[model samples]
Target: MKIHMTRILTLMLAVFLVIPAFASAAPTTKGSAADLRSALGNLLGEHAILAINTMQKGYDGKADFADAAGALNANTDELSQAIASVYGDEAGKSFNTIWSSHIGYFVDYVKATGAKDNVAKQKAVDNLEIYRLAQAKFFATANPNLNEQELAEGLKMHINELLKAFNSYVAKDYASVYTTEREAYAHMLMTGDALADGIVKQFPTMFTGDIMNNPASDLRQTLGQILGEHASAAVFAMQKGIDGAPDFDQAAAVLTMNTNDLSNAIASIYGADAGKAFNPLWSSHIGYFVDYVKATATKDNTAKQKAVANLEKYRLAQAKFFATANPNLSEQQLADGLKMHINELLKAFDSYVAKDYKTAYTAEREAYAHMFMTGDALSEGIVKQFPAKFETTTPTVPTSPQVSTVTMQLGSKTIHVNNNKMMMDVAPFIKNGSTFIPVRFLAEGIGAKVKYDKTTNTTWIMAGDDKLAFWIGQDTMQLNGMNKKVGATVFVKDGRTEVPLRFITELLGWNVAWGKDKATIIMTKAMAPASAAAHNMATDMTNMSAGHMSH
Candidate 1:
């Protein structure tokens, strides 16, 4: 098992990057104690997410943490930076030390598990206990008149649950691991609730002074609901992964249920309609998975073929769902999003099938973790789109932005181009909306077979010798030979010809994605010759033999 550089880098990058913290303050002139509390609480929630995400990734066989773990660390760093921004350098240093230690304990657990040493494990656990005490102490000191005992108790429960989750993974009892992880998550909600309660109780006037009466403060309830639902979803995904259940419905149920949580969070920040739109679209994903699993189980090639045919149906419905949810989003943007979600699920399932324990873990980490980011993006987009209902209500801090555009990074240059361009530039073609270049391009680019169709003006892009053909035309596409319409109207924009950006890249057998309104076309060139003498390649980019994309 050779771990490709892309996957390794992806794993590493996923665990390290931090997301910007968004702690809503009163639309007032000065920073109040309530603002500080909100910031700190938000930071804590963010850290909790990161630490757990990282630990899960370690179990998955990627880096020491999941990609979300990186987001978590980034969150902690942001918190420290935020404190420094408002407080001072001293406060930042203090925050960093306390925060980093908790992350350290998680790393220690990883190190112990890697070494398979009990003494080291116990030492790590003991250190975490100490760290936990100090962690609570630090928070108490920051907000002195705070309930130190209650905070400590909450911290203890959090640490214990995390420890139990990790230890169960070490013990290879995945079911127990997921269960404990859920409880740990549930504990976080309780702690968050307690903290919110304390805030209301202390100031009396802060929470509209009717703190006692408003036990279900929208802020507290919203946070609790968001966090609790996320935890449950994470646990469910983990449980399914570990259970090795072949039932797609069960796995999809876990994903679908979580999507509901995500939808509610979005609704809280957006509105009812936006949330409602998310349901069928969200459910459709489960439907696709269910279809795929059923096809996979029958061991019938015909069934598998039919199941895959549903990919287009799934993609369109899913894409429409996003468009309906956020009308402002461009068709291209929505299409890219749909592909990303599709890729994540497929890659995740592939890892499971391959028994790539490490990759499986990474997929599990993603399944459990990425929703917050999704919720956040949808919420933010909606917040910008609509204002009144969510004026005072803060958006649940979202995870990192979803990979929005596809890019192609080969050697030194990270190129920006659509999937169609990449496919046609490297391969031969009909030169209409389907930019045809050369068959050798697929072979050179990512080892997919490129066959021509003189009779029908089609090009068949196949992964290996599989019957699957990525069929393309001027106006339509048949991925593995099923007619499917694309989001972007496939047309020749220039003489070179242009196809729907994502379609061509994916057809070329590359992992295509959208990030920050850009395209990311990642292709693992497994067999390209190292020496020029071994392979001759001199195709003019300006004018290939294939029909050109006449503007």
Candidate 2:
């Protein structure tokens, strides 16, 4: 039995540069996280298919190997372009050098496997191990969040799968070979996902908003998947249609399935009526692409013209649907974008028919990327129209108060008041042997009204039947016309009036307990006489001052 070089090469290439090719095809411009993921996923998935096909042909000594290699090269160029878009041309070139070396090693592995040379096989494996470590180290250094160990493990899994598939093919275990091939393809998708996520997180400004992975933007991701898959499947199906390939039906079915998912997504957001309206409008454009492909394949000039004409009409209808659905989206702009989408797909189909493989792949990438923009535009419109459904919100200031179970420390600036239901802006701090808290926060928390007489430099506190007034810089406070001494006078900090915590809490008939070990002052409603509470508070205050106070 003749050992097929193509079979081994197919699996090897399927697992090697396919992932980098997908990674490189990621949209360089700031897109939604969903868009980035979809781009990488689709590119990786497609490259896997091409890489596997290349190996199969190479093994069989068939002529199609050249086309397969061309497609893989096209994927690499797109990948490098994506990298150049993000990291600069020099970085992209550097990446190409390192990335190409691994592919060469995989080629060497396939060649050695064909010869059944044990020593050569071991050398290839050794080189791959070095490549894996180098690749992991490079990514780990580039992305702080991506651990070197984790990346090394992931790369090892990829290499092992390819090797397993190649070995199975050599042993004539066709089932195992195909099974491993599928696993290798799926693995590249996972790799693309990880790579896209890490890059997006590391450079959030390069993506739409800094929240691509945020659960709130799930709708965006879902839309990107549905629409992006449609673009990829539809384009590939069109190419198959032109070739009259046996898998054309299956490819076409995938396109239809993607359309159904998109319709369901729309129905979930709008009513079934809107989904019904959207389905045909969306499906019509796909039909026109098939028509264009068929016409091109048959050299039917008239049918080609008709398909183009129908697509123009489809564009207007789709644009109108979105404009009517979302007030924020302009119909004219949507039409223009849709037109570009149509042009890209047509160009790709035409190039494929013309056997201009490079242009076909490039156009395919552009068409695929355009769908992300479509998903983004549609999702943005839907989010705007039904903000509550998507659970989208304006970005909040990081320092703004968050509503949660409240907790506070004695010397910390963060105070949890109002029965731990809300956080207050004022932070409590120890000052001059006393813990000073924001008077406004304390008063509001305890249902008291605080009034400051700016001219007189006096602050007044009004509770149900209690009235207390204090003068700034004065040690004496008036409690219903009786003078009482306070440890510290009222002062302003951070635009909030600060008062001694113990004096204010005790005066309002609230009990204060000092936790010396925890450095916490727990306050609750007093159950004893105000005088008893004041005595306990005074003792605790002295202890707190002696043990924990700082000027």
For candidate 2, write residues 1-551 as lDDT tens digits: 53221222223322322233222122221234544555565555555545654554455554444665676666665555555555567866866776666666766777777777889879988998998888878777777746565467567766776777667656766555644554455456556656666676676554553223232234444455455556656666787687776556755776665676566666655667887899999999989888888888788999999999999999999999989877978999999999988898888778777777667766765665567557667666665665433332222343332332224566565555534454556677765435677777666554556898989988887654455677887655665443444535578777677777745653442434444453665665422233233333333222211101000
Q: What TM-score against the true fold does each predicted structure earn?
A: 0.44, 0.52
Those runs of model 1 whose alpha carbons end farther than 4 Å from true positions after fitting are 1-46, 56-72, 113-117, 189-281, 287-551
* Model 1 residue 41 CA deviation in Å: 6.6
- Judged by lDDT against the true structure, how good is candidate 1? 0.45
On residues 95-208, what C-alpha lDDT tens digit does candidate 1 reach at each position?
788867877777888877887877888888788778777877775666533445435655666777677777777666656564454445434543443444344344444334
Candidate 2: stretches off by over 4 Å: 1-94, 102-130, 153-222, 388-551
* RMSD list, candidates in order: 27.5, 22.8
Best by TM-score: 2
User: Candidate 1, TM-score vs. the true structure?
Assistant: 0.44
